[model samples]
Target: MQTRTYNHVDYLWDDTKAASLENDEVALFLYRSNILGSDLRITNYGGGNTSCKTIEKDPLSNKEVEVMWVKGSGGDIGTLTRQGIAGLYTERLRNLKNVYRGLEHEDEMVGLFNHCLFDLDSKAPSIDTPLHGLLPFKHIDHLHPDALIAIAATKNSKKITREIWGDTMGWVPWQRPGFDLGLQLEKCLKENPGIRGIVLESHGLFTWGDSSYECYLNSLEVIEIASEYIEGHVKKNGKVFGGQKLESLPSGKRIEQAAKLAPILRGLCSSENNMIGHFTDEERVLEFINSNDLEKLAPLGTSCPDHFLRTKIKPLVLSLDKEESLDNFNATVQILQPQFEDYRNDYKEYYEGCKHSNSPAVRDPNPVVIIYPGVGMFTFAKNKQTARVASEFYINAINVMRGAEAISTYVALPRQEAFDIEYWLLEEAKLQRMPKEKPLSRKIAIITGAAGGIGKAIAEKLVAEGANVVMTDVNQEALKETTKSMGKDEAIQTICDVTNTTSIEKMFDLSCLNFGGVDVVIHSAGLAISKPLEETTMTDWQLLQDVLVKGQFLLAQFGSDIMKKQGLGGNMVNIASKNGLVAGPNNVGYGTAKAAQLHMTRLLAAELGADKIRVNTVNPDGVIVGSKIWEGEWAEGRAKAYGVSVDELPSHYAKRNLLNEIILPEDVANAVFSLVAILDKSTGNTINVDGGMANAFVR
Candidate 1:
């Protein structure tokens, strides 16, 4: 093999970090894995495995035994920790070959892995464990680097492998990952005594060495060489993806078109269940989507099992006519609906043709990925992270296709083989082992005024129920802090001035871009001004109307548009006040605005029922604790109006109510949650979170 300089991947190893952990082999193995995983070019998220062999004292025998530490199933090497590694008895693993019933019974070996556990508390070992334990080296790295897979996924992969590294690297034909493949690796290494690594056709690369440092270097070297060779060929072979056939829309236009298309696609594809959506116009994605080969190549599917499993068998390609414009979103939807139906029918056919007697039942027939010619890619899944990761994996597949086509004809895994991996009994078992889905697992919510106590509480509650929230507020600082408190993957923050229609549109665009489409809209952004009729100024009245009444209208108008396009039933909760129904002293501007908000909810509920959009009101009173409205002039004015100090207002208002209880932000949140999640059949109604305000009761 030629010794080439590193160009594509970084040599991230630090000698200082390595020397400190020289005494501990497991720590060194983790360090190697972390640095290698830090680069996506080395391995995709949770797509590869690594292992180290160490001598440790046996817990039972009190004697030294060789233990193999490999990455556990469902763990990502990038953020791997000690607890994430599965420690197995190396001797026990080797002895399993004695009972092996060949490739037909390879899955049974995964269940038997528990018996070989060196530590009872260790994580479950992955299927790739045998590939690591059977290897003769002390350290090994198995990665699905794009460059290497580019070579592996070609029609003439073996021929290309030999030309790239000559005899220094070994090659294994495509096979499902199991004990059989592990035996193949051991045999390949035994035959090629001095080779550094072996490239698994249509799979990935396996490299090993006697020490951790040597193994890390071997993996990087193989990836770097393959990257260089592929780039050289791609540079010589000018046109990629048969060259771009459609001109890409400008960036802003692309986002506009994507925002409009996402919810419609999301709605059409979410017939079986609710799905979160993610939109990406990344350069590579646009290049492929705009290319002539997109229809030809995407339908061929992906070569790697990891890639297709996340992205589905193929992406639904959204083709547009020369006369069609995405701005006419309704017309575009007319085209998409039929195309989606055809795709689902084709998927069912694919399942019926390939399913075996014992194969798991057919899964969701909707395509997880959708590609638009002039726009970008839209991916949908049960959650935000899954949708995002699916997009990343498809991008990886795009790169693989690019490189393979540049050097030779790109080839995909056979349909039967892909089907076997997709519906494998073990894969089905793993799916069954997953924890039950949370109530709101696939729901996406957008909360306006989320920086305030009520909005923040609502966000927290929704997220706790497994909803992804796009928390929007005019207050940037508070919004940042509130979004930070939630899981970063579940919540995202954007500054949205609800009074501004453009800002509201942009916020919905962001919601579609981040978490797919909006399923719930919480209209909580408002202000309070307490004064007698004479003292109230035009400014205060106009501001209240704009922020409260108008803001709620625009938010609902835009939000319901997305929900209607999504075709899934949605929820909208308007946080009105008890004052909206009661005639209260020194409250004119705020009271009228609240009444407008309350009535608007009813109007929207009645009008939007045809689309299955539920609109409701949650009325709260004396919510002084942790409320942003209470921090301003509204608290002092209300206190003065009731003849009490600001500090005494909570108890005074509580006593005024029949129940004599102090209402809180959490109370309002609970009301909203109940209406949306529990009161599935109720809409155009009002829920009172006040401490029994009989005077303000809904009539």
Candidate 2:
């Protein structure tokens, strides 16, 4: 049972790092938590808690007492810091056992945990605090390791555990985690005095030791032995998941299907709240999805409560045949649409059947995880990170299923038990305590020429309001630098040529793959020229039309397809110029292009009205500061035409305007934001960001 070398998981305890901690037990505990949490095979994000009992002086009495430092609620072990750890008086936590009424009042104990806090400023203790606090060990690790859970979730888990560890590891029957479960663990330990750890049936593993190093090694040893045992049976069993029933599509084809399907799923799933999406075609995911047992086992759901909590009670499995192509998007939509509605109905029935009189109102009836045989998996959430992590947890569930089937039949938690955990008041309280979402939360935007001033400003504004953005520009370096400060969850950058159809397609594909689908589109890619008609050539006219007019058309045409497929109303804003409406001297090519852009907005608004897609235009004039167009020949040409130096053009243009005000890129950005997020009722309209341009009046 004491396996020094690990084959399934890494032994990451660095002796030098442990030595550096010296007598600081809390630091050693965090180190153990971080290293164990680093591997998803051991535990997932926010899935486990690690703790150590340390001797600390009581602030009031100035006498030494044992304090239990454990991971706080909503904290991930891998990223846990000192502040994320809750410090509770060990003696006081144990003393609560005497007053424990019964299982009926288990929730009350969570509130009482605050009274036992060694530090009032400590983070809130998780519901699992009692599981760690009641134990007599100096250090404890409660982890949902897929390998251990593989052994734990099977029907014959007790038999398999005995075969693997004999008397070294004890077994506790399935019970919802609470004061009672902690008492069960204590009673199990007392009976099996020789046991070094206990396997919580259908839950996870609990391992401990008197020292931090011993506890870490003990956890690794138990997980390794269980993993090796599972792997042995897995190899002996040959094919997994009752053998694959459907063949996986080629990588290119899979991605193509994912891109097409993600938007539709995202839209349907967003019935309760707008959701961001994540797609994964990881080999393990494809294996499970392609298996014959997928449809049968998927309905049974994940075995671990942590897994089900994130992935939901079950995934919505699509009935897509391997030979079928998602080429006919509408045909595919018609087929899946009814299935989606049925899933909602089924979830509602589950809630109604399992409800207690005081249970919380049913949550979003839509499934968080969706599976397609030939393609892969799609996960939708309020944000990108959650979507991605949900996908990860589902994959963990897959591994558990695979292992369980190899040794024994995989079993999911009972429906009634699952409902209790899902609707627990403590969980509801945690949800209510979360900060309110941002104005544009769960919205995705695609901005063109995002490396430039006006486009970049719009990208920043949308992202700040909680939109995931796909920023596209011809300048690779500028696009990258502009998106450098933005997180991947917020914005991503790619080189795009609005004139090239292939480039436009790839950009949209990237957006679909990264953030589910598009909700907003801002066409700000443009250039300006100030020249007399006699001096302007056909080449100048063609270039302006290609970059400005043609670019916006392609984006709208492509972007509209996705929005329509989603059946979700969307927003499109074209950044035009005051020169479009106002007849100006020495401006012909640029003015005509802007006018074309203005009309295109009107056309789109009228055409996409039935689909609830809003189209509008933001016309800004004389944006001298932070305007890329001003850094070129247009500024010089305009200055010469007005008989002023290039440096004086800003002041000249500002003074020429009725309000004598200069415009910035941000000014134009504000107009676009308003048109997209605020002016919901108005479309086919133009908002002028220019300083009182009388000639540019719409009339």
Best by TM-score: 1
Runs off by more than 4 Å, candidate 1: 1-5, 327-330, 658-660
TM-score of each: 0.97, 0.96
Give me the candidate number with maximum lDDT: 2
What is the alpha-carbon lDDT of model 1 when measured against the actual structure? 0.90
- Per-model tally of clashing residue pairs: 2, 0
Can you write out model 2's per-residue Cα lDDT over 181-263, one digit (the tens) per residue? 99999999899997999999989999999889999999998898888888898899888999988788899988988887888
Off by over 4 Å in 2: 1-3, 653-662
Model 2, residue 293: distance off in Å is 1.7
lDDT of each: 0.90, 0.91
